[model samples]
Target: MTVPTLSALATQLTSYNPDSLSVADAQQLIRDYVQATDSSETVGLNDALCRVLSEDVISPINVPAHDNSAMDGYAFRGSDLGVEAVMFKVVGTAFAGHKHEGPVNTGECVRIMTGAVMPADCDTVVPQELVTSASEASMTLAPGVVRPGDNRRLKGEDLMAGKSALRKGKTLHAADLGLLASLGIGQIPVQRRLRVAVFSTGDELRNIGEHLDEGCIYDSNRYTIRAMLTRLGCDVLDMGIVKDDRESLEAALRTACESADAIVTSGGVSVGEADFTREMMAKLGEVAFWKLAMRPGRPMAFGRIASNGKSAYLFGLPGNPVAVMVTFYFFARDALLRMMGGTKDSTPLIQAASQTAIRKKPGRTEYQRGILSMDANGNPQVRVTGSQGSGILRSMSEANCMIILHHEQGNVNAGDPVNVVLFDGLC
Candidate 1:
C-alpha cells in the first residue's frame, strides 16, 4: 500500500492547520494515514491471547455435533403430552457420550442424562424434577408442565458447520480462545505483534538508579510508556533516555526508524531552548509540529520518519509526565493499534455526573484525572483528582477515569453531565 505524505493528508483535511490543530482533526489525520501491517503468523490457541486475527475462523463442524438433552430428564415425543396426567414407560437409559441403541416409540421414553443425545422420535424432554411421580419402570408428568422442545438442545444450535465463528481484525481474548477451542481449532493465524521503540528526551532527565543532580528528575515517561505498550501486546524496544542534543537525538531516531514500526518520544516537542527532539525528527522524517487545541498536551509532533530507506511513524509527545500519558492515550494509542493490525478500537466514553463544579474554557479540550464511583443511587459520579497539573503523575495514578471537557464546552456546574473514559477499559 502507498503511504500518503503529511502534506497530502493535510490537503485532504480542509481544517488542517498543523500549528493550531484540533484534537479531532489530529486524530483523523493519523487514522487516515496509518494502515495495518499485513504480516501474520500462526499461533497456538493458548498463545493467541490479545493478538489480532488475520483471517476469519470457520467452524468445521457443528458445535454440539448432534441433537442432545439439555438436562437429566425423560425424552419422549411431544405429541404424547395431553391435558391430563400422562405416564411414560421408561424403555432405556442414556448417558452422556452414550447413545440409546433403539428408537423411542409412542408412550415410551428414555431416561437421558445431560448432554446425552436425544433418541430419534423424541422432540421434548421433561426434567427429572418436573416429573410428578416415578416408579421402577415408568414416570408420570403433570399436565401443562412443559411445552414441545423444552429442555432439548438442537444440533448446530450454538454454532453451525462451515460458519464463521470469529471475524478477521478481532483482538483475541480468553473467551475467544474458548470459542476457537469449541470449534476444534488448535492453531490460527494472527497478525504479528507491533514493534514500538520508546524513549524520553531531556538533558536533565536521569534514568532510575542514577543519582539525580540538582534540578534534574528521573525519567518516568519511558517506564509508563513501556507499561502501556505491554498492555497493548506490543513488542517494546526501550531505547532509554536520549540527551537534549542534535547528534544523540538524530542517532536515536534513525535507529528506531530502522528497527521498529513506530517510535514514541516524550519531551522536546514543546518550544524550549534545549529541545532538540523536534529538530531531529524534522531532519530525519517528514514530521509535523502542532499546537493542539487541548490542555496539558498542546504541543506535539507527528508524521512518518525515515532512516536508511526504512520508515516508521513518530509521535513526539509533551515533556510533562501527565501530558505524555494523556496524549498517548488519546492519540498515539489508536494509531499504534491500527499499525498492530487491529480494527478501530476506540475506548468508549460514558456520561457521568460531576460531583463538583469545574472551571473550564471553551476552545480547547481538557482531560482531567478523576475518581469515578457509584452514588447512593448507583449512578456513576466523578470528581477530579486533586491538582490537575500536567506534571502531577500522582493524579493519574489516583484516577480511575478521565473526565473529558470537550472543545466548545463551557464550565461544568455541580451535578451536570460530563463525558468520562475509564482507565480500566483503555487497555
Candidate 2:
C-alpha cells in the first residue's frame, strides 16, 4: 500500500473527521506526527538527573548487595525465637556503611544498624526499639514477633545483577539518583535539552518596569512563556517583545530561526487588523494557521522556521494570558517535548465530576478553569472558578485544572462528569 505523504495528510485533516475528536484524539495525533529528535550523549552523574536516559541502565550487582537489616536492631536466626534475646553473644558489630566480613556462628547474633549486611546465619531482624540493650555485645528481646525476613532487605531482592534497571527513555528523578549512586554509575547517556525561543507581539504591550501608557499592559506572555519553557527542560532564549510592525517582527523571527530549535509567540495569531503573523509566516515557510474549534485559544498558528541546513518550529498562540496557557498546554508544550527527544509528551489525565453547574454556548470546545478538591474516596471533585472569560488572568491563578467541556455540549449541571486536566504535572 502507498503511504500517504504529509501533504495528503494535511488535505485529509482540512476536512477533519469531525467525529468530534476528544482531547485524547488530538494528543495521539501529535504523538504520531512528531518523533523525538534530540541527540544523546554521556554526561556525569551529577548532571544526569532529570535528563532523559538514552539507554537502559543495567545493574552490575544486586541492590543491598547482600541480605541486610532495614532497621537498627538485632540480626538473629528466626528459629531461635523464644530465648530472652537469648544470651547470644554479639559476635560482631555491623555498622551501615561498614559490614563485618564473616558469618555469625549458630546460636550467636550481631548488633546490626540499618543497612548493615545481615549475618549469613541470620534470617530476621528485631527492632532496636523492641529490645533492651543489656550490654554492647547483646540485647534482651521482647516477645510477640512472628516471622522470618522481618525488617530485612534480602540480597538481590530490590534489584538483580545484569538485569535491566531503568530503561531507555526514563526521565531521572531524585529517587533515581539514589539508585544510580548505589550502582556507582559515574556517568549516563542522556538526551540533549531543547532550545526554545520565546517572544510576543502587540504595540499595546509594554515591558515590565516600563511606565505604562494608556491601554498598555506589561508584556507578560513572553516571560510566562519563557518560564514555562524552562520548566519543560528547554534552554530558553528571551527574544524579548517586538511591535506589530513587519520589520521588527521579521527581524525577531529571523533571530529566533537562526538561533533556536523552536520559537513561541503570543498575539498576531488572531484575525484582526493588527495581526501580522499570518503574512510574515507565509513569507518564511509553510505555516498552518488553524481555526481550532476551541474557545479562548481557537486561533493557533504552527509551522517550520527554516534556514540554511537547519529548521525550527513556530507556535503563535493567542495573546490573552489564559488563552496563552491553555494553548501552550494543549499544543506547543507536548510537541516541543517530543521534538526534544523526551519520552512522554502528554500530561496525565483523569475524570472528575463537576461540583457546580456550567452554561456553555454550543460549537466551541471550552476549558473552564477550576479548582479540584478530593472527596472522601480520593477522587477529584472539581468546582469551576469565577469568570470563564479568556481575558481573565485572575481565574487562571485561582484554578488548578482546566475542566474541559466538549464541543456542541451545553448546560452541564452539577454532578456531571467532566475532564479535568491537572496543571501541576506537565513538566
Candidate 3:
C-alpha cells in the first residue's frame, strides 16, 4: 500500500493548519499518511505473542477431525428416548484417545469418556452423573435428562477446513496460540518489530546522575518515553539529551532519520525563543507545526524527514512532563502502531459517572487524570486528581484512567457521564 504524503493528507483534513486543527483531524491525518512496514518473517508459535500477522491464516484441516463425546456419559440413539425412565445395554467402554468400533443397535449404548470419538449410530449422550441406576452391562437414565444431539461435539465445530481463522494485521495473544495449535500450525509469518529513536532537547535538562546546576532539571521525558515505547514492543534508541543549539539539534535529527523508522523528541516544538527544534525540522524535511486545540499538549510537530536518502516519520512533542506523555499516548501511539502493521485503533472509551462537578471550557479538548473506583452502589465513578497542571507528572502515575473531555464539550456536573480510557486490561 502507498503511504500518503503529508501534503496529500493535509488537504483532506477539515482544518490542516495548526491554528485551526481539531483532535479528530490530527488523528485522521496520521491514519491517512502512515502505512504498514513491508518486512516480515516466520516464527515459531512460542515467539509470536504480540507480533502482528502478515497474512491471513486459513485452517488446513477440520478441528477435532471427527465427532467426539463432550462428556463422560452413555452414548445412545436420540430416537429411543421416551417420557419414562429407560435402560440400555452397555455394549462397550470408550476411553479418551480410543474409540468404540462396534455398531450400537436398538436399546444399546456405549460408556464414553470425554474427548472419545462418538459411535457411528449414537446421536446424544446422558452424563454419567444423571443416570438413575447402573450395572456392569446396563444403565438407566431418568426422563427429560437430555435432548437430541446434546453433549455431542460435531466435527469441525471449532474451526472448519479451508476457512479463515485469523486475519492479517492481527496482534497475536495467548488464546490465539491455542487456536493455532488446534489447527496444527507450528510456525507463522509475522511483521518485524518497529524501531523508534527517542530523545529530549533542552538546555536546562541534565542526566539523572549529574549535579543540579542553578536552573537545570533532571531529564525525565526521555526515560518516560523510552519505557512507554518498550512496553509497546518497539526497539528503542535513546539519543540522550541534545543540547539546545542548532548544530547539535541538526546532528541528532539526521542520525535518527537514518537509523529509525520513527523519531520522537520532547522540549523543542513549542513557541519559546530557544525552541530551535522546529527550525531544524523545517530545514531537513517537510513538517507541519501545529497548535493543537487541546489542553496540556497544544504545541506539536508532525511530518516526515529524510537524511542521506533514508526517511522517517517525526513526532515533536511538548516540553512539560505530563504534556509529553499525553501527546505520545493520544497521537504518536496510533502512528507507531500503524507503522508496525497493526490495524487496530485506540482502545475503546468507557463511560462512567463523575463524582464531582468538573470545570471545563467548550473550545479545546481536555485530558484530565482520573481515578476510577466503585461507588456506594457498585457503579464505576471517576474523579479528577488534584491540580490539573501540565507539569504534574504525579497525576498520571497516581491515576488509573484519563478522563477525555471532547473538543465541543462544556462543563460536567456531578453525576454526569464522562468518557474515559483505561490504562490496564486483562491479558
TM-scores, all candidates, are: 0.96, 0.87, 0.95
Structure candidate 1, residue pairs in collision: none
Angstrom error of the Cα, residue 254, model 2: value is 2.6
Supply candidate 3's per-residue lDDT for 382. Answer: 99
lDDT of 3 at 265: 98
Worst 10 residues of 1 by lDDT: 280-289
lDDT of 3 by residue, 1-427 (tens): 5666677778877666677578889988877887778899999999888888899999999987889999999999999899999999999998888889889998999999999999989989889999999987999988899998999999999889999999998888899999999999989999988889999999999999899999999998998899888777788999999999999999999999999999999999888888999999999998877889999899999888999999899999999999999999989988888898988665999899999999999988999999999988989999999899999999989989999999999999999999999977310
Order of quality (TM-score): 1, 3, 2
Q: Is candidate 2 or candidate 3 better by lDDT?
A: 3
lDDT of 1 by residue, 1-427 (tens): 6878878888888787777898988999889888888799999998899999999999999989999999898999999999999999999999999999898999999999999999989989999998999876999999999998999999999999999999998999999999899888999999999999999998899988999999999999998998998888899999998988888888999999999999999999888888888888888878877899999899999988898899999999999999999999999999988988788897889899999999999988999999999999999999999889999999999999999999999999999999999999463
Q: For model 2, how does the per-residue alpha-carbon lDDT over 155-177 read when each residue is reduced to its tens digit?
A: 88989999988888787888887
User: Residue 33 of model 2: what lDDT?
Assistant: 54
Locate the minimum summed-lDDT window of 10 residues in model 2: 17-26
Top of the candidates by TM-score: 1
How far out, in Å, is residue 109 in model 3? 2.2
Off by over 4 Å in 1: none
